[model samples]
Target: MKLLNDDLRNQLKEVFQDMKDDVTIAVFTKSGTCNTCTETISFMEEIETLSDKIHLKKLDIENDAELAKAYDVQMVPSIVLLNKDEAYVGIKFNGIPAGHEINSFIPGILEVSGSGEQLPEGFLKQLETVKKPVNIKVFVTLSCPHCPGAVQKAHKLALENEFINAEMIEAQTFDEISNKFNVSSVPKIVINDQYEFVGNQPLEVFVEEIQKTQA
Candidate 1:
């Protein structure tokens, strides 16, 4: 059965129409090992059909170790969003972008497709002062409504600052990593693997946390 219904497909066609540059979505999945791998691939496939600018690349994480390592994808059912030049813009989804979290997927595509020059002026100003790299990982569950906002902010930060690498990891799928970070709650955001907080935060607060880590 197809995942996207006719109405949703039409809506997506309009949404993807805003895409000005080519957007490539690279899906990494290990066959037969990850429960959601197959479904994730199917979802991406359907999404590709929505727009001429959207392209999908399928890969097996186990078979393509180098490729996976390049994207820092340590888990299956992961997605790497690239721009027209096939350059990774530090946007990743380390699990199925289902449920409410799916809302973040399209925005990620549009951001990377463009020059990612549409960040808020204030955030852009703040990002320019950062001299060090900041790595942000947001742990989320598929069902979490608040997860998408946190994930979107992280991706936006990555776009605003080249020194930032942001990713969204599915908490349930990556049990070991999630446990290591003590991710018992949804939308748990960790910055530089040093500072972490639970729940969704405002844009100013989130940027402040990044600045705190930089300090």
Candidate 2:
């Protein structure tokens, strides 16, 4: 079954036309362990067909244990974006990029494909002050409409800052992880396991939350 229709495919092709570099979508999924693993692969395959610059590398955690560990993918249906240089930029999608999260996924590929930074000068300056390492885990569900904004913001920060890493944890697929974080709602932003907030926050508010991690 095809996930994208002809019209959507054309739109995506147009969106991807600006890609200056190739992007590799590294996916880790295990058969029988993840209910959405097969479908996620199919969805990525369809997206790959829309752009020449997009490549998909499918890896099963069970079979590719070492690679999975290297990427720190502890759950199934995990995806990480890498640039043409094969460098993992720390932009990760821990769940199936479905629903509103698809908005984040598409732009992630484009941003990773481009050369220059997507962030503004001020944002970069703020990130420079971040001396401590920050690990951000955004808990989301495919049905959540507001989750994409938080995920996109987290990903762009990860892309720009070497000391920060952001991951989108599918609340449903990684129930144990979600439970650990007490993610009862969608778009639960956890920073360094110390500071956390809910909902889609303004960029400044998000930055303030990140700053709180250093306190």
* Model 2 TM-score relative to the real fold: 0.93
**Compared with the true structure, what per-residue lDDT tens digits does model 1 show for residues 71-150?**
88888889999889888778899989888888888888888888345767888888887779888999999899999999
How accurate locally is residue 116 in candidate 2, as Cα lDDT from 0 to 100?
42
The per-model lDDT (C-alpha) reads 0.88, 0.87
10 residues in a row with least lDDT, candidate 2 = 114-123
- Report the Cα lDDT for candidate 2: 0.87
Measured by TM-score, the strongest candidate is 1
lDDT of 1 at 31: 72
Please estimate how well model 1 matches the true structure, expressed as its whole-model Cα lDDT: 0.88
The digit string of per-residue lDDT tens for model 2 on 1-215 reads 78898888989999899889999999999878578889999999998888888899999888999878777788888998989997887788987998878888988898899744567788888888988888889999989889989998998888888778899988988889899999999899999988899998887877888988776
Itemize residue pairs with steric clashes in candidate 2: none
Candidate 2, residue 37: the lDDT equals 88
All candidates: CA RMSD in angstroms?
Answer: 1.5, 1.6
Runs in model 1 deviating more than 4 A are 115-117
